[model samples]
Target: MKKLFIAALLFVGMVSFAQDAAQPVKQQRERLTPEQRNEKHLKKLTTELNLDTNQQAQVAKLLADRSAKAQKHMEMRKARKDSSIKPTAEEKAALKKEIMDEKTATEAQMKSILNAEQYKKWTAMRDENKEKMKDKMKERKNKL
Candidate 1:
């Protein structure tokens, strides 16, 4: 009986070590360059909206501009985060207002660029993505 118990303990230890050894390593993914990302996004939009050459050029330019602005915003945000300073209520309100303004401007630009049907489809896609983001945030909150 003592011999059997010792063998069972040894088996459990080996199984635990085997499970740990079999676990997969997480790999770091290569990120695309900004230009490459922009081009890929443009191609997707072209395919989805059936954009003409002229529209494609315009959209590409628009995307590049938007990307630049977003990059700048991200840098500023990172700097603020690094500073470790909490924003005041008024500052938070101002930042929220600025984001809303940018959002409205982008929507207006999209409406100008796309035809009625394309704009409608684009809005639908945007809303769907927004919902997905909200769901993801909720899931993260729940997890935490």
Candidate 2:
């Protein structure tokens, strides 16, 4: 009887370990090209804003232009990071001003392209996304 009890315990332990070992590992997400990403974003905006064909075309062009500029900016940031160089306070202020100016210009262009109602909705969506990003950053900080 004791020998049978010992045999059953060993069998259960082996089965649990084997099951864990057989579990699949998590896979990394697939990367999309810049154009593909822009297209996807454009489609989402079209659905959300009920954009007309002409509006869609304009939005697509705007998205593509934004993506290109963002790619360039990211490369610049990466290069700065790689060089381990810290910007002076004046440089930081200039960079901030440039970013704010670009943002204002982009908003102006979007307003020109979208109708009043659409522009309102776009701004609301943008604010919501900003809040979501802030929450995510806070969560990451807490984790650290």
Question: TM-scores, in order shown?
Answer: 0.75, 0.77
Q: Rate the local accuracy (lDDT) of all candidates.
A: 0.73, 0.75
lDDT of 2 by residue, 1-144 (tens): 112233344455445556675565445346678899888889888999999999999989888877787777667767898999988899889877877787788899899999999999999998997787567556645643
Cα RMSD to the true fold for all candidates: 15.0, 16.0
Residue 34 shift from truth in candidate 2, angstroms: 1.3
Candidate 1 per-residue lDDT, tens place, 14-108, comes to 45556675565445346677688789989988998998898899889888877777677667666888999888899888977877787788789
Q: Highest lDDT: which candidate?
A: 2
lDDT for 55 (candidate 2)? 93
Off by over 4 Å in 1: 1-27
Q: Model 1 — TM-score against the truth? A: 0.75
Per-residue error at 135 for model 1, in Å? Answer: 2.6
- Model 2's alpha-carbon lDDT is 0.75
